[model samples]
Target: MTKQPAHIVVAGGGYVGLYTAHRLQRRLRRELGRGTVRITVISPEPYMTYQPFLPEAAAGSISPRHVVVPLRRVLAKCRFVPGAVTAVDTEGHTVSVRTVAGEEAGGEPLRIAYDELVLAPGSISRTLPVPGLAEHGIGFKTVEEAIGLRNHVLEQLDIASSTRDSAVRSAALTFVFVGGGYAGVEALAELEDMGRYACRYYHNIRPEEQKWMLVEATDRILPEVGEEMGRYAQRELRGRNIDIRLGTRLESCEDRTAVLSDGSRHPARTLVWTAGVKPHPVLAACGVPLDDRGRVRCTTTLRVEGVDHVWSAGDAAAVPDLTAPPADPPALCAPNAQHAVRQARRLADNIAAAVRGRPAADYRHRNAGSVASLGLHKGVARIYGRRLKGFPAWLLHRAYHLSRVPTFNRKARVLAEWTLAGLFRREIVSLGSLEHPRAEFELAAGSRRHPEDT
Candidate 1:
């Protein structure tokens, strides 16, 4: 009787999934070629987005196409499946997937059996039950959201420039971003810079006329950069006339008005929510043991605890941080790119070791500090007990992430874009029609009437 090949299925194509499967392709080359091992990577999108460049992409400093790496092009040795893993059956070693095509057709999900499972489904934006939030709030996680936000901001500028009504203009010029973390701060800074720069071309609007507000539930922003640097960032943003509302919560956004807990209300058209993230929901349905925070419980080796033939890591797993000091309760690895990338490599190595009947090694690495780009020619960094701010930190931020971006092709493209951006003026054109490509054509053909026509 012939021995069936072992199938390994990896969920999520973010940092963990991409690097893990990429390394496995190299580590299991012998088994792969001998038809003894097979690897399949599944995710909603076919590309892995390098999220650090999203703000630059949104601000038009880098081309959006250059920020994502195509999985098929990079993982030649492994199969790529473009779908989301809806549920996992740990006992039966099977996962249910809903492909994009099947989802559009409302068809049933497909089930695939695997010998080894990697649960790195990642996380989603954590939201609240605030009224009108679902209708008005925009998320900044994916490249689509980032680019759409760029278009939307420019469109708001257009509305402000042309509107005769004061209320309409005021609302159009006001932009509110909730959350003080890297995503919220960087996005608000870049877009505000872009919007202000764009004001130069409009005869009706001034840079000061644009109201940019950042609301944080906590007293400080950029907590990852430490307290001193966070205060510096706050001062820098305030110097530019940005309203920094600290220790404030959003009470409601009904009818496009932002009502805060401090009894202040602002009628704003754009509200960006980047408060935080929660683990993906598939972990709850998978029947695997999970931590109190809803992440899969995994050993330091990245193997799922109390589950056979299963491994997990990244934002979806609660792997202990061996680097932390011994205490009554040890700290877990943070859900950030620094840990995710390293954890992935370790996970792949342990899987290869298990295949060859070797002992698994625990994943261990100290945090490398944090760097954040505030906007063009501005940033903050904290590394190895040293602090950097202003232009030097900005340059370091670009250099660090540019080197970390996957593929030499993407790196070259991004560096080239940065070079060109420095030499030329920023692009502020709004391609909002890209969101609805067939609107004009449909109107002309009379197949579909415009909303105004109805």
Candidate 2:
């Protein structure tokens, strides 16, 4: 009698899940051929987004499709499940997955048993209870949000350009971004640059007329790049006429009006929230040990603490940072793409080692500095104990991220975009109507109905 192959289920298809599955397929190729190992990846999306390029994608620097890598195309050897894992029962060795809507299964949730489980569901936007946030605020986390923001920003220009009311025009032209982390800073910088360029097409709206404000609760921005770079970034932004409000919090955003803790109020149609992220809520229900911040508790080896046949990493895992200096108190790795990508590789190798009855190795890698692109020909980078700013840093930022954005196919396409963009102007067309394609059609249909028919 032949024995059934052991099934390994991996959750999430972001940086961690995709790379882990890719490495596992390469390591267990022979075993896979003999039908002894089966790897299944379950994720909410069919593709993995290279999040570092999101700002550029939002600014129309890179094609949105190029920033996302399709999982099925990349992981032919692994079983790809286009759904989300809602719950995990480690003791029962089963995971409850909710299939995407419009599927043959009627969007029902099903349970699948696995011998080994990898938890890397990743994080979601950490929002506050600020008034009107749920209705007015937009996030910068997903590719959809990035593309939508681009369209929405351009649409605001159209509204401001054609509107007669000064109040409406002011609100439309005023853009407010909360949080000063890499996401908020990069997004604001890129979009502001795009908006400036886009103003050439609008006769009524001037570049200076657009109010670009950045609100940060902290005293500085871009903390990942250290104090010196953060200060440099602030100066550069202010030089570009951006209003930087430090040590300020957004108290409310009711009726498209932003109220800051500093007792200032601004009527803005666009409000982008890139404040931060929290671990996926699914982690809390997975029956796994979680840390104080609601992240999966894992050792340096990337194995879930006190949990057999289970491993975790990425933003959702509290894995100790082995690279931290001896003087610093014990700390976990920062939840960033730099750490997530490396941890995925180590987690994959460790899982393979355990399967082959070998000892697992600890995951350790020192911080490799930080890079931030402030629009075209502008950036700041801190690498190898050296600081770089302006054009040189901008070139390095592009080079570094271009090399890291997954598959060679995507890299080629992105390079082609940059090459073409150099020879031509940036594309700033608005496609906001795509979000509600049927609205106009519905209105037309309704208008055609006679009163007598009603």
- Candidate 2 lDDT by residue in tens digits, 252-344: 999999999999999999999999999999998899999888999999999999989999999999988877765444788999999999999
TM-score result, candidate 2: 0.97
RMSD of each: 2.6, 1.8
Candidate 1 residues lying further than 4 Å off, grouped into runs, are 104-107, 447-454
The local distance difference test score of each candidate is 0.93, 0.93
Candidate 2: stretches off by over 4 Å: 101-108, 326-329, 444-454
Tens digit of per-residue lDDT, candidate 1, span 1-454: 9998889999889999999999999999999999999999998998999999999999999998998999999888888889999898988999999998888999999898998889999989999999999999999999999999999999999999888999999999999999999999999999988998999889999999999999999999999999999999999999999999999999999899999999999999999999999999988888899888899999989999999989999999999999888876778999999899999999999988888889999999967789998898999999877899999999989999998898899999999999999999999899989989999988889876679988
Model 1 residue 390 lDDT score: 98
C-alpha TM-score for every candidate: 0.96, 0.97
